[model samples]
Every structure is written in structure tokens, then in C-alpha cells.
Target: MKLARDTWLIFQRQFLLLIRNPIWIFVGVFQPVMYLLLFAPLLKPALNAPTQAEAYRIFVPGLLVLLAIFGGLFQGFGLIAELRAGVIERSRVTPVSRLALLLGRSLRDVVSLIAQAIIITLLALAFGLTVFIGDLLLAYLMLALIALMTSAVSYGIALRVKSEDALAPLMNTIAQPVLLLSGILLPLTFAPSWLRHVADWNPFSWAVDGTRALFAGDLGNDRVWQGLTIVAVLTAAAVWWAAREFARSVR
Candidate 1:
């Protein structure tokens, strides 16, 4: 009960800060919109799908996952800024629970991801993407879980590194490999056999595949369940690990 109350109050504070700066949403929304408008049409000829809408099924899911990755991965920048501003250091002296601090900020990240995702979805629809509402909602749920896990890990990294100069290169190095392995822009089904084998080991590929399935209206696909289960477990572990780190820092 106490945790929930503290988290809610902290979330309100974080959310208001986000509301006052709406440009972040626009920045996140732009790349996905570009892909939907410009890049997707290029893939339509090669999609092998029967219709333009079918091609969108393949492209839009990847754009959604890509948005989640870029949005969630850089979340630590805000924490680092707060640290330098002595905001986090000040919070350490407050009565707030350390876990609440992480959860509150992470909730703000999820909200941002959701709003960007909705804009992307609407724009995709305008570009001929067809979707089932329930499945689309499920895809967004997957994204939120992914964001939660990534945001927690980002916060942990920010606390450890504490320098944007070092952190930027480190995250970029990590993100490129994950994006390549996950096949975010294109499905790996047509990849070389060896490359497909490599993608199989990337847990994110499952999320991509699951979301692709959802986008195709295949709600009962096993990949969808596997993706959900993987992200849920990862989110729980990340939260625990991040909360522990934050608590140790406060101490």
C-alpha cells in the first residue's frame, strides 16, 4: 500500500514534468512516421505479400518495436541529467522509497512510448495498414513491457556510468547489435540460414516476430505467447535489479 501511494505521487511529479515538455513526443514520433510514409512504400514491391496492406503488416510491427527500442534505451539520459543537477542526490535525502523513484520514472517512459505508438499506429492506418483492435492493443502491451525492462536497465547503467560521454558510445554500441540481430526493419525469415540461426538467439527477435504475428492478425500464434512471457520475466528481473541499485545508491 505504501509503495503504491509513493509510486503514484512520484509518478504524478514525473508525468507533470513530461507534460510541460511535449517536444519529446514529437521527436520520437517523427522517425516512425517517416518509415510509414517513405520507407514502407519501398518495401511494398518486395514484400511478397498479396496486397499493400499485407506489406504494412510486416513493416509496421518493426517500426513499433524500433520506436520502443530507441525510446526506452535512451531513458537513462534523463536520470544522468538529474544526477548532475543533484536532483537524484537530493531525492536520496527524501522519504521517497528508492523503488518508487525507479517505478515512477519508468511509468512516465511507458506513457511516452504509448503515446508515440498511438501516433505511429494512426499514421500506419493512414498509409494502408490494417489492424485488429485487440491484437493491436496486445502489441502495445508488449511494447510497454519492453519499455519497462529497457528503462530499468537504462537507469541502472546511468547510475553506474554517470557520464553521458561514456554512456552514449556504450549504448550506441549495444543498440546496433541488438537492432541487427532483432531484424527490426526486415524479417529474418528470408535471411541466410546462418543469419537466421543467429537471430534465433536474440530474445528481441521473438518479440519482433510476435508483434509481427499480432500485426498480421494471428492472435493465437505461439510466438505471441513466447514474446509476452519473455518480456514479462525480463521486466520483473530488471525492476528488481534497478530497484536494488537505486536503494544501494541512496544508502
Candidate 2:
């Protein structure tokens, strides 16, 4: 009960902060829209084959996952900035539960990412894309999983890096390569043989594949189960790592 109460307080604080600075939310929505509108069309000609359409549909889920990942990853900036300003330290000295502090912040990102995913889905629909209700629900669940994984990943980075200024370059460097290697913009089929193998090993690819399966509506139960298993394992590992990092930071 204490943890729950503290988490609620943390949620309130985080939500208020978001309300005060709405630009972050706007940018989150805008970036994905731009990508879908600009990049999707530009690449449409090259990706027009039947296999490519299937691949492209599969890619949409990955893009949604990316939206959540980007939102959660960048949220670490808020934590780093607060720590630098001594705000986090001040909160730490209070009766606030440390776990609540971390969980609440992470939950905020998850919720925000869900909202962003909805926006992206709506935009895709506007573009004449069709997604079944069941498939959409599955995709949303995948987005939630991605957000949780990303939050944990970001928390680990935030705890280790110690400074917001030091985080920017590292975040960019890591995020770009992960997205590219995950086959977000290109299907693994078209990737060079070596790169195709690499994409198979990527956790992000599993997410994309799973989400694509959900959207495609004909995914086998076993394939869906496999994808879920992979994402669950990754999310669990990330959470464990973040917990250890958070403990170290508190000490």
C-alpha cells in the first residue's frame, strides 16, 4: 500500500510536468507522423512487390514499437535533468519509496507511449491502411511491452551516465543503429546476407515480426507465442538490469 501510494504521487508529479511542457508530447506525435507520411511514400515505389507489401505491413508494427521505444528512451533525459538540478536528490531525502520513484517515472513513459501508438495507428488508418480490431489490440499490447522494455533500458542508462549532457550523444549513437539493424525501414529479405543474419538475432526484429504478425491477421499461434516469449524475456532482463542500476545509484 505504501509503495502504491508513493507511486501515485510520483505519477501525479510526472503528469503535471508533462502538462506544463506540452511540446514533448507534440514532438512525439509529430515525428512518427512525418516518418509514415514522408518516408513510407518515398520508399513505396521500391517496395511495391507482393512480398514487399506484406513486409511493409509487418514493418508498421515495428514502427509503432519504435515510437514507444523512442518515447521511453528519451524520457531518461527528464530523469537526468532532474538529478542534475538536485531535484531528484531532494525527493530522495523525503519519505518517497525509491521503487515507486523509478516505477512511476517508467509508467509515465509507458502511458505516453501508448497514446503515441494510438495516434500512429489512427494516422495509418487515414492513409487507407486496414487493421482488424483484434490485430490492433495485439499491436497495442506489443507497444506496451516495448515501452516497458525501453523504460528499463533508459533507466539503466540514466543511472550509469550520471549527467544529461553526457547522455545525448550516447542516446543518438545507440538508437540509430538499433533502428537500422532492426529492419524498420527495410525488410530483412532485402538486407545483405550478413545483415539479414544480424537482423534475425536482433531483439528489435522479434518485436517487429511479432507486431507484423498481429497486424497481418494470419499469424500462426506458435509464431505469436514465440514472439511474445522473446519480448517477455528481453523485458525481464532489462527490468532486472535497471533494478540493479537503480539500487547502485541510491547507494
Candidate 3:
């Protein structure tokens, strides 16, 4: 009960700050929208998709995951800013639970990412992408899990490094490999046999495959459950690790 109340309070404060500076919401969506408009058209011929709609169905899911991955990984920059400004240091004197501190901030990032994802989905609709509402919600849940996992790790890293210069290069290093392995732009199925085996080791690849399956209206696909389960475990571990970092920093 105490943790929940503390989390809500912190969430409300952070959320109000977000409401005041909402431009970031659109800024984050812009790149994806550009891809949707300019780049997605090329996918139809490249992937041999039957129609523009089919191409979007393939593209949008991976795009959302891409959004989640990059968005979440980059969030540590904000933490570094706050640390320099003494925002986190000030919070150390408060009675808040350390875990709540991490949860509240991460929830904010997750909410923002989901809103951008919704915008992408709606735009994809205009391009003729079709999906069941139920499956769409499930896909959103998966994206949320990814966001939560990435956000926690970002915060943990930010607390450790406490330098924008170090954080930036480290995140880029991690992001490049993850992005390549995830196969967000096109399915790994098209990759050479050896490459497919490499992608099999990337959990995000399972997530991409699962999301594509959901968009295709395959609810019971093993990839869906596998992706969700893998992400859930990862989320739990990340939150635990981040919460520990928060405790050490603020205590």
C-alpha cells in the first residue's frame, strides 16, 4: 500500500511535467511517421508483399518495436540531466520508496511510447493495414513490456555513468547490435540460413515475429507467447536491477 501510494504520487508529479512540455510526444513520433510516409512504400516491392496494406501490416509492428527499443534505450539521457541538476539528489531526502521512484519514472516513459505507437497504428490504418482490436491491444501490451524493460535498464545505466558522453556511445553500441539482430525493417526469414540462426538468439527477434503474427491475426502463434514470456522475465529483471540502483543512489 505504501509503495503503491508513493508510486502514484511520483507518477502524478512526473506526468504533470510531461503535460507541460508535450512537444516531445510529437517529436518522438516524427521519425516513424516519416518512415511510414516515405520509406514504407518501397517495402511493397522489396518484400514482395501483395499490396500496400500487406506491406504495412508487416512493417508497422516492427516499427512499433523499433520505437520502443530506441525510445526506451535513449531515456537515460533524461536521468543524466536530472542527476546533474540535482533532481535525483533532492529526492534522496524524501520518504519515497526507492522502487516507487524507478517505477514512477519508467511508467511515464512507457505511457509516452504507447501514445506514439497508437499514432503510428492509426496512420498505418490509413495505409490499409488491418488488424483485430483484441490482437492490437495485446501487441500494445507487448510494446509496454519492452518499454518498461528498456527504461529500467536505461535508468540503471544513467545512474552508473552519470555522464552524457559515456551514456550516448554506450547506448548506441548496444542499440546497433540489438537493432540489427531484431530484424525490425524486414523479417529475418529473408536472411541467409546462418543469419537466421543468429537472430534466433535475439529475444527482440522473437518479439518482432510475434507482433507480425498478431497483426496477421494469429493469436495462438507460439512466437506470441514466447515473446511475451521472454519480455516479461526481462522486464522483471531490469526493474529489480534498476530499483537496486535507485536505492543505492538515493538512500
Candidate 4:
């Protein structure tokens, strides 16, 4: 109960900052929207869907995963900025649970990612994509889990390096390969056998594949459960690690 209350308070503070500066939300969603507009049209030859809408069914899920992966990873930039401004230093003196402090920010990120997802979903609809409500909700759930996992890990990275200059290169290096291995732009069935084996080892690949099943309206599929399970376990492990790092940093 105490941890929940502390987390809520910290979430409220971070959410207020989001409400005050709505442009940050827009900027965060812009790149994905651009892909929806520009790049989605170019997938015609590669997508085997019967219609443009069906093609979107396959494409949008990948974009959503792409958004969650990159957006969650980049969240630590804000933390680094706050740390440099002495905001985190001030918080260290507070009686709040260190876990709550890290989790509160992660909660804020989850909300932000969901909001962007809604925008992306709406745009996809406008472009004639059809999605079942239940599957859509599940996709959002996946996004939340991915956001939780990535943001927590990103926070740990930020605390350790504490420098945007170093973090940028490190994140780019890690994120790019993860993105490629995850195969968010297309299914890994297109990959050669050995490469497909390599991609199977990526946790994010499970997630992307699960999302593709969801968007395809296969709610009962094994892929969905497999992806959800992996994401849930990874999220728990990441939160544990981030909380530990936060506890140490506060001391």
C-alpha cells in the first residue's frame, strides 16, 4: 500500500509535466506517423494481403512494436536531463520508495506510449485498416509491457552512464540491431533459415510476431500467448533490476 501510494504521487508529478508540455507528446509520435503515411505505401510488393487494408493489418503491428521499442529506449534521455538539473538529487532526500521513483517515471512512459499508439491506431483506421477491438486491446497490452521493460532498462542505463553523449551512441548501437533482429518491418519468414534462428533468440521478435497474429485477428493463436509470456517475464526482470539500480543511486 505504501509503495502504491508513493508510486501514484510520483506518477502524478510526472503526468503533470506531460500535461504542461503537450508538444513533447507530439514530437514523440511524429516519426511513427510519418512511417504510416510515407513508408506504409511502399510495402505493396512485399505484403501478401488481399487488399490495402489487409496490408495495413500486417504493417501496423510492426510499426507499433517499432514505436514501443524505440520510444521506451529513448526515455532515459529525459531522466538524464533531470539528473543534470539536480531534480533527481532533490528526490534522493525524499522519503519516497526508490522503486516507486523509477516505476513512477515508467508508468508515465507507459501512458505516453499508449497515447501515441491510439493516435497511430486512429491514423491506421483512417487509412482503411480494420482491427477487432479485443485484438487491439491485446496489442496495447503488449505495448505497455514493452514500454515497461524498455523504460526500466533505459533508466538503469541512464543512471550508470549519466551522460547523454555516451548514452546516445550506446543506445543507437544497441537499438538498431535489436530493431533489425526483431523484424518489425516484416515477418522473419522472409529471412533465411540461419538468420531466422538468430531472430528467434530475440525476445522482441516474439513480441513482434505475437502482435502480427493479433493484428491479423487471430486472438486464439499460440503466438499471442508465447509473446505475452516472454514480454511479461522480461518486464518483471527489468523492473526488478531498475528498482535495484534506483535504490543504490539514491543511497
Q: Model 4 off-target regions past 4 Å?
A: none
Error of 4 at 235 (Å): 0.6
List the candidate numbers ranked by lDDT, top first. 3, 4, 1, 2
Worst 10 residues of 4 by lDDT: 42-51
Writing each residue's lDDT as its tens digit, candidate 3 over 109-152 gives: 99999999999999999889999999999999999999999999
Candidate 1 deviant stretches above 4 angstroms: none
Comparing 2 and 3 by TM-score, which wins?
A: 3
lDDT of 1 by residue, 1-251 (tens): 88998899989999999999999899989988988888888786787777888888898898889889878889999999998998888887789889999999999999999999999888889768888999999999999999898889999988999999988998898789889999788889878999989988888899999999999899999999999999899899999999998998777
Over 4 Å off in model 3, which ranges? none
TM of each candidate vs. truth: 0.98, 0.90, 0.99, 0.98
How much is the lDDT of residue 56 in candidate 1? 86
The clash number for model 4 is 0
Worst 10 residues of 2 by lDDT: 49-58
lDDT of 4 by residue, 107-212 (tens): 9999999999999999999999988999999999999999999999999999999999989998899898899998788878888999999998899999998998
**What value does the lDDT take at residue 157 in candidate 4?**
94
| Candidate 3: Cα lDDT at 231 | 94
